[model samples]
Target: MMTGLHLVIARNNYVKKLMGLSIFQVSVIMLYVSMGKVHGGTAPVYVMGENGEPDLGVVYSSPVPHVLMLTAIVVGVATMALGLAIVVRIKETYGTIEDDEVIEKDRQEEEALADR
Candidate 1:
């Protein structure tokens, strides 16, 4: 995650920023999945006691985090696709995906317009 954050901020290429964002997102998902797992945990099946109440001594892990991560994975894919699409549009408009170059071009265009 730290590496991704560094790349996202330090890189000048728009594609590298997207790649860093993807890495950070994957690391977060992995962290959540690992946290949801227990050492000796089993599936979340409940056992019934003789008194008809659910047994409370089970060491089953909750499925909520895993389920939520599944949704997150889907959303992450969609987000990546959208980011790539935007980058494509930026490249089309600016003819370069380098952040510095794009900004320089915009500034130059502004200067030219000002002189006119």
Candidate 2:
């Protein structure tokens, strides 16, 4: 039942639909971040040993996933920001965020145009 409700909510055509998508995107990013972390590994920061040499003995976790997720997070934030901006514009123009209403409004406009 809960899953069905979420599907309905996600399918709605309101402006700011990006807000819902952003939640899923963030969750995926978190999953990637969790997958990137190692149980016994240290951070990727560079450190010099007492001998003034880079320590290579310690087991370092893979950096690829961490780096990739970081990039994805940045892109996701930018994408969300853009979606919000578009939604704001949509509300300002249509005075409503609902998709059904917007489509109806357009249909009426088209009919009025056809009548002319």
Candidate 3:
């Protein structure tokens, strides 16, 4: 019985570790996107030429990365929302939020069912 409980606890801890890793990965991706926005050039708009014609020396900032980041943000939010919902369901079904507790409860329930 003790061995069975230990196994359950170990499995739960592994799951929690995996979830934490996923959160870390998301944070890193967000950081990368944010760091890509900094620019040292002037705006891509024309002010005036030497003879008042038009100034074409101004550099336009790239909007491609920003647009991609917006898409990534939306996708990340949706993924996080879905993951949270699944976590909520797991908690409700197991009657505990801690990974080990949930696994232990599940093991006990399974044992009870098998004894019948």
lDDT of 3: 0.62
Each prediction's RMSD over C-alphas, in Å, is 3.3, 4.9, 9.0
* Candidate closer to the true structure by lDDT (higher is better), 1 or 2: 1
TM-score-based ranking, best first? 1, 2, 3
Weakest ten-residue segment in model 2 by summed lDDT? 1-10
State the lDDT of candidate 2 residue by residue for 1-116, as single tens digits. Answer: 33334543766565335656666677777777778756546655745668986566664566888789889989988987887788778788888778888788889999999999
lDDT of 1 by residue, 1-116 (tens): 99889989999999999999999989998899878865455565766768886656665566988899999999999999999999999999999999999999999999999999
Off by over 4 Å in 1: 39-43, 46-59
| Candidate whose lDDT is highest | 1
lDDT of 3 by residue, 1-116 (tens): 33334443455543454455455545655666666553444444546768985555654444666677677778867766777777778867876667768878889999999999
Residue 88 in model 3: shift from native, Å? 2.5
TM-score for each candidate, following the candidate numbering: 0.81, 0.69, 0.53
Predictions in order: lDDT? 0.88, 0.71, 0.62
Candidate 2 TM-score, C-alpha based: 0.69
